[model samples]
Target: MEMIFIFIIYFVIGLLASTLGAVAGLGGGIIIKPVLDLFGHFDLPTIGVLSAATVLAMATMSLVKFRKKGHKTDKVVSSILAVGSIFGGILGKVIFNIIAISLNMPTVTGFIQSATLALLLTLIFIYFIKKDKLTSFVFKNRLIILTIGFILGFLSAFLGIGGGPLNVTILILLFSMNAKNAAINSIYIIFFSQLSALILIALTTGFSSYDLSMLVYMIIGGIIGGFIGSSIVIKMSNTQVEKIFNISILVIIFVNIYNIVNLLY
Candidate 1:
């Protein structure tokens, strides 16, 4: 009964995170990280792995939906990004291993809390400063997209965030793509980034035998949430959705920071 209850909770959280991720491209990590923190059993590294798993599932689902909708994603852009991301992911895994050895801590767990918080804050600051210009630029330049991909790939590997928001922002701000195109392309980028990162982690870190059941629950939740969130996006304005996403990310960042500080003391 207790296990069932916990499963239900995880499922719900997963659904909510994935839904937000699909709709606004910024919800999975922001939502799932906090909820897992509340459980007090998984710690940060476990949560990071779980979050990555969820993001992969969500991205895959989004890709399918985008394909059904006839969105034109630039395959060449995706390929370039994937190559850079794979190399970056290897570098990130090395950094993680070094941190683990030096600090005597599980690298993923030790860094996830602080990393997620930092990312959340950075994203919020960027969103506020460029609120009006959120959808301003269109990135027709393949070289520029490749550059953005390298940066995003590094960050995604380091943070386990799936790179949705980063991809979306670059597509809209730098590429001048519309929201739908940006959202679709972001899914493609995340798919590649996540795949590359997962491969690197598997090769370097060797997988941990955490609770597989929990991962399954999260994946199921993410898939359902993604579907619902995608449907919701069709009914809402881009500005409103983006604002909600930005505010939510800000709140999550502060909360995670507070928790990390508390843990320190």
Candidate 2:
């Protein structure tokens, strides 16, 4: 009964996260991590593993759906970004392991992590506010796309995010791609990044023995929710969809920072 209850909870959370992720181009990890933390299961490394798995599942589903709908992405751009992202993710995993080994104290580690996150959030905010300028600059210099892709991959691995938020923003703003194409490309980027991160984690951390029953439940819920969310997004205007996603990410960043601060002090 207790095991069943836990599965139920995970399934519900997965459904909610996947639904939001599908509509906003954010991954289920962004939502799942905080909720898991609230429930006292907030191991960052473990969450990283779960997040990568969730992203892989969600991205695969989105890719199929987008393809079925006749939405195609830029193969050349996607390939370049994917390659950079894979290397970046591997590097991030290595760096995180080093940090874990070097930092013996959890408090110090927490402080460092929180501060770094705060800085990242500030930069993200600035990017959004001046999106026009950033877009112009990036479009003029296509090389900037590779740089952003690499950075996003590193951050995704380190932060255990789906990388959709970062990838979608860059695609739409930097590449000046339409919303649908940007979203499709984001899925492709996320799929490659997740695959690389998963391999890194498997090699470094080994496989975690999570409850298979719970995993199946979450995956099923995620699939259903993803379908519903994608359908809803098709009906909404691009401007409205973008606004919702940006607001959701802003809220998530602030909440995560607060949680990190609380954990530290």
Candidate 3:
């Protein structure tokens, strides 16, 4: 009964995280990692692995739903971005593994990871709040878009996020895509990034640290939430979606800061 109840709670967290992820085109990992860390339910790598699975499931579900609605996506752009991201993901995982081996202290490693997450989330939160014009200019170039995708992919692997929020922003502000189309494309990019990262991790670490049962429950919740969120997004205006996106960023920022503080003390 205790195990069942715990699974239920995890499922609910997965559902909420994935719903926001699908709607905002940010992968659920951003929420999952911090929340799990705060609860002390899992270690960093375990949380990362589980979060990657949840995000992948959510992205896959949302992709199917978005397509069924007759939404058009830029296959060429998504493909190029994904290609860059895959390599980035692999490299990021390599770096993480190296760091893990070198550090040797669990607490110190967790602190470093949490601090990194906090810094990135803080930047993302500021980006959402500032709505900088320089962002538009920087993303205008195709090469820059690809480069950013690669960087985000690295961050996704290193931080175990889907990198969807930044992807959505780039698509909308740079490519002039509407919210729905951006969301669809963001999922495609996230799918590739997470898949590559997961594969690399499995190959290098052999999956000895994973909690398979918890992962299964979380993925189930993510799929359901993604479907529901995609359906909601189909009916929403761009403005409404943007508002939700900003709010999600704000939440991530606060949660990450708290996690960093906890890790410190």
Candidate 4:
């Protein structure tokens, strides 16, 4: 009964997180990582892995829905970025294991992750408020795009956040992509990155060692959330999507701040 109850809770979390993730392009891990931390039911590494799994499912569904709806994406740019993200994901997973498992310091690792996320989100928020005044670049160079994707993948995988926030920001600022196109491409990039990370997890720890049942529940919720979120975003205007994205970013930053404080004292 307790296990069943826990599954239900996880499903709810996944549903909410993925819904928001799909809408805002934050890939749901931005919410999942911090929320799971607050629950205090699992270790930091466990939370990261679980979050990665859920994000993978959410990304997959979001992409499928976007395709079915005939939403257009920057395929060339997204492809280059995704290729870089795959490699970055592997590196991020390796670093995570080194800290959480090898060093046996999950608490310190958690603090680092939250602090990093908070810092990144804060920077992104600042950029957004001053976006109009600031310059936006459009790089045609493939190498630059790859570098950006690598950085985004490393950050998302390392912090256990989805590629949405960072990916969207980069797309908008670096490529001058509109919010809608950026969101769609964000899903594409995160999918490959998260898949690489999951594969690493399978090779290193083996999926069986972890709580597969918990993931099953979360995945179901993520699928539902992905479908609903895709439905909502396709119909909405760019301005509407940005409004939600702005609000969600602020909320996530605060959550990370709170988490950082909790980890410290």
Best by TM-score: 4
lDDT of 4 by residue, 161-247 (tens): 867899999999999988878887888888888888888887778876565557888888988998888888899888888888889
- Cα deviation of 38 in candidate 1 (Å)? 4.4
- lDDT tens digits, residue span 40-124, model 2: 5545555566666766777778777777887677877887888878887887777776675445443454455555655665566
Segments in model 4 whose C-alpha atoms lie over 4 Å from true places: none
Clashes of each: 7, 0, 0, 2
Measured by lDDT, the strongest candidate is 4
Please say which candidate is ahead in TM-score: 1 or 2: 2
RMSD of each: 3.1, 2.8, 2.2, 1.3
Estimated TM-score per prediction?
0.83, 0.85, 0.91, 0.96
- lDDT score of residue 47 within candidate 1: 72
- Candidate scoring better on TM-score of 2 and 4: 4
Cα lDDT, model 3, residue 186: 87
- Write the number of the candidate with greater lDDT, choosing between 1 and 4: 4
For all candidates in order, the CA lDDT equals 0.67, 0.70, 0.79, 0.86
Sorting all predicted structures by lDDT, with the top scorer first, yields 4, 3, 2, 1
